[model samples]
Target: MSALARTAARLLLGSAMVGAGVLHLTTQRQEFRAQVPEWFPVDEDLTVLSSGVAEIALGAAFVALPGRKRLIGGLLAAFFVVIFPGNVAQYLESTDAFGLDSDRKRLVRLFFQPLLVLWALYGGGWLRRHPTG
Candidate 1:
């Protein structure tokens, strides 16, 4: 994709992350709590809150620090990977949240995680052999 497209993607993803982070800390906090795995030792509320903060920081950095896009994008992708197990637990444990009420919905949701990773990488110009700003 062109640099313009990559930039657009990066901006959109950053905006989305910011929005999601806000949700995690605000109205959707309870809903986000459902994503925390029972096996995970951290308090659900704390996890949600911390992740929310992380999302906001990373997203803001991704958008405001173009010079560090590559690093920020990688971190964002790692964040997605890190949260993936929670998604899996939700599916396997039949825990429902965020409208993923059914097994099929939860299962299908898992497939999108990789796309998020790819989006981060591509938007950060990792996919380009010669990335152009």
Candidate 2:
């Protein structure tokens, strides 16, 4: 893909991430408290706020540090790994935390989550760009 295309793809994905992060931050308390299990390690406010902050940071890094995308992407990969448990937790607790109807439905998200992580990690800049467009 051309540089313009790469930039466009990056921008679209990055902006979406930022928007998602902001959305999470804004809705964290009410949503998390209602959905997350009482047994979770972190408090509701903390959980929502921290994850939102992390996502925003990750999103910004992906956009602003494209030249250093490897390092930033690696960070995002690690972030995804760190957050996988929450995904698992959501299902294990049988909670529609992110608005999923049931554990079975949430399983679909599990598959996509890992793929998103991989996309961030394996996305271009180091080698030849993929046909992201």
Q: How many residue pairs collide in each prediction? A: 0, 0
- What C-alpha lDDT values do all the predictions have? 0.95, 0.71
Which runs of model 2 end up more than 4 angstroms from their true locations? 1-6, 32-38, 124-133
**Model 2 C-alpha lDDT per residue in residues 1-133, reported as the tens digit of each score:** 5667656656666676787789777855576555445677888777777777888887887888778777776777777788777777777777776578787887888888877676666653433545675
Model 1 ranges with Cα > 4 A deviation: 130-133
lDDT at 11 for candidate 2?
60
TM per model? Answer: 0.96, 0.78
Worst 10 residues of 2 by lDDT: 121-130
Give the candidate number with the greatest lDDT: 1
- Checking candidate 2 for backbone clashes, the offending pairs are none
lDDT tens readout by residue for model 1, 23-42: 99999999999889999999
Task: Please state every model's RMSD to the true fold in angstroms.
Answer: 2.4, 4.2
Candidate 2 TM-score over all chains jointly: 0.78
